[model samples]
Target chain A: MAVSRGFVGRRPTDSARVPPGQYVTRDFPVLSAGPTPYTPLDTWDFTVRGLVNRPVSWSWQAFRALPHENITVDIHCVTKWTKLDTTWSGVSLDTLLDAAPTQASHALAFCDGGYTTNVPLADLRGGKAWVVDEYDGQPLDPEHGGPARLLVPHLYFWKSAKWIRGLELRQADQPGFWEMFGYHNYGDPWKEQRYQGD
Target chain B: MVSKTVETPRVTTIAVAIQDWPGHRAGQHVDVRLTAPDGYQTERSYSIGSAPEDAYVSLTVERLDDGEVSPYLVDELRPGDEIELRGPVGGYFAWDNELGGPLFLVAGGSGLVPFRSMLRHHRASGSRVPVRLLCSARSLELLIYREELIKLAADDLVDVSVTLTREAPDDWRGYRGRIDPALLAGCRHGCFGA
Candidate 1:
């Protein structure tokens, strides 16, 4: 390893909480591949389709009527910023997936801006993920995927597709926007898997 | 590192020579990793500043008051120091001359870094894409590539408009305040066919 001269990292007191090559950040950094889409709540809806016994869809009003949970979780961005204890409220993927039974093992999360990210159905089940519309007691801003966004806290934040629309269950796994590029298919920060070959 | 240039008060551009670097496209980024003497390592992604035609990879870093890596990159590391970096990664945002245009690019602060690569690629490739750029910075003094942007604007095919959000010089003659829909509409009108 090439040691940088006179460079000492933040050296977080709780080092174990931070993944390797990552640092803690209090401020939320907004990163987007394109302009933020402003989808009116009335037209916004969430769906679960493809490889399911029966497709399911929920309009904004109906989705909000579903049981919601307040969650505080650590979000790790592949950019190396880890914001811990971020609070959010949303309907769990299990609640939505339970409504539509599927034996498929993977899903391609499609968003409003033509952006997509793939996640294992297993990761989306068991309350591991949610389609969040609220962050920190306020309606999520359009820039932060207001209306709704998929929240998969375990993987890199990019996998948490903003402006999330629906999940298309797939029999085989495939690459999404960043994954088609150089980013790793499964971005696990703990393993330092950032690039395709990493 | 081959050379370093101070772009602004808080920004510095560092060019490094890479061995067998597989040249990158415009708007690509690289992951820069730095290790401490105690074996502690940290990494951050930075947009590539140099055009693909350039001989070396250049990265423009903006110093953040509390940033773990930016401060060290902007203020400390010197030429000839070895730093580990990966890629020219992220193709989702990359641009190439083949894409063709009426291209419209908008950037604020350090966000202009990648567009600089695109604009350079635009010029170097001799692409006659009618390009319009609307850049925003806190002030003229804080603007990166101020001189180069002026030179690029001289091209009949390229139009560069800057907006100073916070402060502007007494003689400044450009847009002011944050980018609003009206400004965007005007910019869009200039590039895209009405």
Candidate 2:
């Protein structure tokens, strides 16, 4: 490490933004929501709390066997690059909302790492979101928040929390980690909501 | 100072000429992107700290630990290295005399990048609005642009406030604490803009 700082060795290039391509399951896996993988299915439970008529709690297998599928899309990170054409599998937020029977005006998804993000119920049911379990064709990778990460395509990537264990539907809108520290709240790419002022 | 595009790791500063190759605004940030050996892409947005009047653009790149971007920049980039970047990417934070007042610049870590642009642009434009730049760093060694900033503060072109969070030398006489409101008041109010 040179005592002097502030020089980048390489030129900035879109050369690094890999094009959309095929993916498979091994490339992805559910990771790090809770402490372990084989969480005793019978003993395992997740709750859907936060602003709803009836909070639903269910076992792991019960949620798994309900219904599942996958989708492919592009992800734009706040760090400033757009990754195109990736695949994922998981339950749709619509399905979860339907089963959970929530009339809450708003919902905040909660997961491990004390992570939470707010999304309106309309956004979940309107085809803009999902509870993605698979990525790049594999079961989700833990680092990418596998097993299940919220897939909110319309908002910035962080809004889609990874390694999610539960949902806490809130009636109000609250900011998340980066938001509390000055990063944008909604984080809409088209709107360029990357930082505070905007 | 060079006009040609160079492939550099991280651009500490860039001076753009011609105002062409897709012109730029002072407060906007460009994406200085690169690819790691493992194929994971590392990209970061650096504010265009250079004054638009200047023939070129400049950005200050402060390295971060495991910083996929900055380390390569400060250590690997050399003169005439090719740089891939796209510019002028922010709006809400930019300076607009259309919405003018005394400016209070507060930066923690790398957050100061934008303010540097705003202040430099102010100087380049020859504006008289007083500006106070408060920079916080872990210690003296980590202070970016230390000599240049001190000169700027001493010149009184800008009122600078440096808060050292840890390991101050015995000779240290400036503020040696965090960014509390009280400490902030200790600075020149006329320059800090309240």
Candidate 3:
């Protein structure tokens, strides 16, 4: 998306990198549909279930015990802000999937307050996604999906649910809250899929 | 586009009745794009000010001296004008009465637009959800939707508090400073826990 409005001044070089309709911003705008949720760490848990013969669950300690990775990537929010070269440390979705193998082709990430977003299983595997708990060497702030959030840097940020608690594999794709409300089911920033049928 | 002055000269309410509104939850916003005759277009997003149940979608815009869109939107646009728009966008910051119970709203300047939608929805739906709104403005004159908010607060279901940062009336009885821990704590007891 190439935004050339006066507010989003454009240069030739910018079009080569930033996705269509997205402007690069040094500031990370805090955009939430509702109030920030505060879930105590002691009560937090991560689970992998649905369509799997044997489901897996992890307490906060158990999840932290898994192998972790430090990653640096750029993230784009569907609301049109892009933060580049962000660093995060967490357990990769690949590692989580390997723990409890499944044959399902789609996944529904379940978060606190019943928020869920569906993604193709392929987009999640191969080092593309992670359950991130730390940002820039600090515990992720609750404002930014604190305890842990699904990090799918390749897609629009809404697919990366905050306060995420689990991933439920499924045989069929089920659109999440935003998806059901006209947001693109598969939000690819490069395509500028901000809404359904975009 | 239909425009009305909501607060001061810089603040104006723009309403449009489109066939595809589909209705939106309170606190949702729409992205608007304005195009010049030569097709040079600029887009900015604004919070929708009308309740979801209203017949038309509306946005309250605050004109900035240097802003490209707001200047034209606030000063040049007239009734029956056309502009491009998309949205009712974002899921992270939306609320409806269905979320149930106590709602605490905090506003700074034009930030009151989305919360206005929430309040309207609450009143229109006859919801009994306890709502407390803490609004911070430069002064009473700049407060948007003042009359409606006052009317809403007349009901036991709603509570309204205002803090004047720049200028306060001589007889002001409300908060006289900016939002701080003390004021936020007051908002917490009877409203949303956080």
Candidate 4:
């Protein structure tokens, strides 16, 4: 299938949209997030392709059927909030790739809404990442990447692709959303990997 | 910067209706957190886009394609929902009058959010520190803080220079490109707040 347009380099523009001090929430969400998701499982479709000798596509059911496992861990974002004691369930990318047999050295992930992040297959294997399908025993909610999402616990939260579509196995790696916009491509919370220059 | 973690709100953005907002300096940000359905929680640090005088915090977020926690904060979030956040994170990035100089703010996309507070502080206290901003976006329509930025420019409170990457056929007459030094140099220094 045709891929959506990737983040293209564009000249920058500026706006003083809202007045300063006006948005100061007496209280703020503990997280930096996009609009809450409205993902519906019936509406979800996950695909994995690229550089692999054979690309694989899995429907939600087909995806869940592949394998199921649960793990509890802490995740940190470069933005600096660390959430601990989180339980997530899903199929491991390594386990899945074990069957698919990826010949590609590099990997780029794409999501349902067409966002992409470049990563290394080595990072995936080394990080003990997975394509998580469930959270806290119940099937994951759509807003939380219901059907499935990529969970890279070691890297910053941005590495966790929401509404994940598939993996594009490439010979080389590429940066994802925040990376293209100047966030550090390899986000390590321990090192405070927030900005590109950082 | 002092911070205390709170609970995630039902909505993403809110009026920050809590009484007695903790005092914070301009150009500071509060760290926010939220709990996912499965008890998995996520956190992100955002610039306190509002000035200390303002009643609430406002964050302008562009949905990241795979932002595990961000999408909920940006898209599904609304005002009046409960959420968790810690006050006024980051010290150096925060604006301090003591730093003492005309301020030139350059922001890329949502990066401009924190600078908003700086402008407001300057405006309220009459800092007169010569503030200028170079905001870069793909198009004029996509410009955030469009109305406010223009008003500030018009009022001579701040010197605003804008560059558009993708111009509409009808809107290509002015500043048709990236922010070059020329744009920065041309901006008349406007300063009311330090």
User: Each model's C-alpha lDDT?
Assistant: 0.90, 0.63, 0.84, 0.63
DockQ of every candidate structure: 0.79, 0.06, 0.18, 0.05
Select the stronger candidate by lDDT from 2 and 3: 3
Q: Which stretches of candidate 2 lie over 4 Å from their true place?
A: A1-76, A80-123, A126-155, A158-198, B1-22, B35-42, B154-157, B188-194
The C-alpha local distance difference test score for the whole of candidate 4 amounts to 0.63
Q: What's model 2's interface RMSD, roughly to a tenth of an angstrom?
A: 10.5
Candidate 3 regions exceeding 4 Å error are A1-13, B4-10, B15-28, B36-42, B51-57, B63-81, B87-106, B118-132, B147-159, B165-167, B177-194
**Ranking of models by lDDT:** 1, 3, 2, 4
Q: Across residues B97-165, which tens digit of lDDT does each residue of candidate 1 receive?
A: 999998888889999999999999999999998988998899999999999988888888888888889
What tens digits encode model 4's per-residue C-alpha lDDT throughout A99-137?
567678877888766667776788788438998977778
lDDT string for model 3 (A1-63, tens) is: 323233333332366567766667778788766668899989999999998889998999999
lDDT string for model 1 (A58-90, tens) is 999999999999999999998888999999999
Off by over 4 Å in 4: A1-40, B1-194
Which of 3 and 4 is ahead in DockQ?
3
Best by DockQ: 1
Evaluation by DockQ, superior candidate among 2 and 3: 3
- Say which candidate scores most in TM-score: 1
Q: Candidate 2 has what TM-score?
A: 0.52
